[model samples]
Target: MNDSLTFCKAIEALAANIWPAEITAYLDNWQLRATRGVTKRANSVLAIGEYPQLANWLPHIEQFYADNSLPAIFHISDASPPGLDALLDSHGYALGTPSLVMIANSQDAAAAAAQKLVKRDVAALTAEWVTEADEEWLDAFLRLESYHEELKESYKGICERISDAKGFVKIRKGKHIIAVGTAVVQGEWAGFLNVVVSEAERGQGLGSYLMQALTAWSREHGAARQYLQVVASNTAAVSLYEKLGYQTKYGYHYRIKYDLRPLATS
Candidate 1:
């Protein structure tokens, strides 16, 4: 009923709704074969907040699969409150990698971009843009995310959604696609998701170019603000984003835990 609880509930709901249907159902009630929008098997972990006890949810989680069969995995951050981790660990879950959550308000961003990088005319991107994605683009996208886990279909789904949806943009150099980004519209705020630049293309200011292009796209789509997340240890990226007008609004971290121990494969 209070403002804080209301906001927390809203955040949980947004996180849940964005996942695939099977994931939502599995987390919501531990059902199987129940596919939801974009969520697929390799991408099945769903985060729930303000929910029932973890002990009660363990059966459903375990029933789905063992360690190797983990259809989906999620890093359960202490975002909920005390004792959540204890309950999860007691059930044989292991902590996973963590990432920092970041946000920016358009009201503060609408002003001239700070430390201007030579503006590339966002429209220039359209000239070199090919299909929303191609085999080469997909390969590069996967390489950037090789550090973490992700479902093949999950990326495909995201690409499908962005391709058909308005307000998505990409920029390329010759046959090589250099930059990509998407802005998910939520009320007055646009969640900037999956901004990636090829490793070979780094330091050329493509990052800032994509940021400005995405920010401009967000504004055109009626978004009043923009936000995105990066790993806490990624100092270089955080510094660049700060220079681009983003301030730390909040942070979310996750650790993956399992319900069963890993079996020897030998």
Candidate 2:
């Protein structure tokens, strides 16, 4: 792998740290993570290096998730071994949620311009900083799913575990919160996670504004490079990030095997 790819992988590693899994186990080059199925990225196995022991690893991974009552999943990225995807396909693991990892130079002109617009309205935006997400942030971001206490607590635990410089941003307009995002800075790299705009507030460019705000916050705190993950099917978000000068660095997806064990016999 070249220097750029290595750097991107390093950022991904940092991301895994920022959003920690409740249970993490390593087998050679593979990272097996589980977080009660709250999020695929947190739950899936990440093949970080050549896994010559993949055959042995699969059974163990299946049992690990089975023990926890979660699906067995693997996050396959460019960093994974060659033919690993085909290998998983042959094993009956179905692919899910292809996503892109995008990166941008924080000092890029376009990003700088967006930052200016967000800075101009800094007072109106009403930024709330929290180490762990409060009910308000969870309500705005998770929306309908916020009613589930376990999921909300899982999110809170993940956010609170970020040891690096991090910020959970809640941007409000008047009494109503309009946007939410999280930024974690490790070394010169800053990763943005869970950036969402209110469903009723789409097309108003709040997404771009949120990105700029997060990027600005990141850069001010010593991050020169910014990275974010987006589902490949989210064209609107991809376009907005592209307009802000982010380019696709790599793509990854989860290969999932659902547990088919029958419920107890009465």
User: How high is the lDDT of residue 98 in model 2?
Assistant: 96
Provide the lowest-lDDT 10-residue window in model 1.
33-42
Q: Which residue pairs come into collision in candidate 2?
A: none
- What value does the lDDT take at residue 261 in candidate 1? 44
Candidate 2 lDDT by residue in tens digits, 74-117: 88887777898998898788989999999999889235556546
Per-residue CA lDDT of model 1 for 72-186, tens digit only, reads 3443433354575676666555655455556677755544353456454433343133345555555655666552234555555555544223344556666556677656566
Estimate the TM-score for candidate 2: 0.89
User: Could you give the C-alpha RMSD of every candidate to the true structure, in order shown?
Assistant: 5.4, 3.6
Candidate 2 Cα lDDT to native: 0.79
